[model samples]
Target: MEYQYKEVRRELAARADTVIWLDHPFATVMTRLVRRTVRRRAGRVELWNGNQESSLWSVFTDPEHILRWGWKSYGRNRARVRALVGQVVVVRLSGQGQVERWLTGPLAAVGEERAR
Candidate 1:
């Protein structure tokens, strides 16, 4: 639950250990290995930085089936990401304060990876 100022995005970009992926896409499929909820739903939820998650009606507009895709991969993604991000510093934070600290602390470095 750490959040860094947008300015920090630049700092992280300079770090070698940091990886930034924009316009990236993936799907979540439920399988025997990944037993999770399959809810075909989307809503216009507010996000940080004055953003909206997405309107529920958009599900029909996007061919990617954003909501359905995400619902399928709920549990599997975390495990996949953790394995993919090996050899990097991982911090499991459970609150927003930790995010504040990282933004003001060592996490300012670009390319540095920390998990919460």
Candidate 2:
């Protein structure tokens, strides 16, 4: 959605009044990904298409490993979202607390405006 469908993304953003960017820290994100992966693998959680998390060793070996992807793309994703600053009304929420605040505050205001 970010690189391939430029026109479609632009149209979607233009149609929407605001975009919320969750710009969590790299360490925070990586930690969460690691923990989630561990939990999923331990539980053998089934996901879409009946897929399950692979061995923990695959984290270092597999090219398509989600943890690896997250580590590699975190900075790029942040930059990509930041680049949308001038293109849309971006509300960047840094952490869970900020997101909760947004859900209760500015987001409510947007709903109220829509109601008006």
Candidate 3:
């Protein structure tokens, strides 16, 4: 469930028992975005609606380019997720290490619970 609007996310969070927020740093987000976009472009992957990644140069020229969009929305997204902390159970993972730990610990427990 990837949501762009804060209102939608808030509504979804209200229904979910827990919401995992990846609070990665801007640099980390940009690096991953670059790698993903390059890989998609090189592989000629077809994204939704038969759309493929635009030229890498578009990052500089296109304000709506995925990379630029990610960069521009990062702060607002962070703030939106932060505001949901008390309203819902938010497990914010700030780094890869935290993410891995949650996967093996809390998340695994939830999975195991469902299996029983």
Candidate 4:
């Protein structure tokens, strides 16, 4: 029998001290997704449990495919994260530069502490 709350993730987030969000432009995300998808399909990359991308045709035919889903959900996710600004210690990184800056700055402190 299940003993956990329905919203366990929210419960955990409430108690968490930090949440680092890797935010990127929609174009960048789409570009990455397309490249990754093409590479995986061409190479027949074995994912979890020997699963691989079945067909390139699915990219066009599958309306709920990764490419479509990512494009559609981008704006909704951005808005949701923006709403979390006051409730959590959210680090919203917009691009590679911001990500690198955080990794070398505030994030480095956390990494150094963990190494001790």
TM-score of 2: 0.78
TM-score to true structure, per model: 0.34, 0.78, 0.86, 0.81
Q: Write the per-residue lDDT of candidate 4 for residues 11-103, one digit (tens) a residue.
A: 666676666777898889899988998899899999889998758788678887778877887787677657667887887888989999988
Local accuracy of candidate 1 as per-residue lDDT tens digits, 31-99: 421232122123444446766545456666865454666655455545543543554444554344655
- Report the number of the highest-TM-score candidate: 3
- Give Cα distance to truth, residue 35, candidate 3, Å: 0.2
Stretch of 10 with least lDDT, candidate 3: 1-10
TM-score of predicted model 1?
0.34
Once fitted onto the true fold, the runs of candidate 2 whose alpha carbons sit more than 4 angstroms away are 1-15, 109-116
- What are the lDDT scores of the predictions, listed in order? 0.43, 0.81, 0.85, 0.77
Q: List the candidates ranked by TM-score, beginning with the highest.
A: 3, 4, 2, 1
Question: Please, what's the RMSD in Å of model 1?
Answer: 11.3
Pitting candidate 2 against candidate 4, the one with the higher TM-score is 4
Residue 92 lDDT in model 4?
Answer: 80
Off by over 4 Å in 4: 1-9
Candidate 2 vs candidate 3, TM-score winner? 3
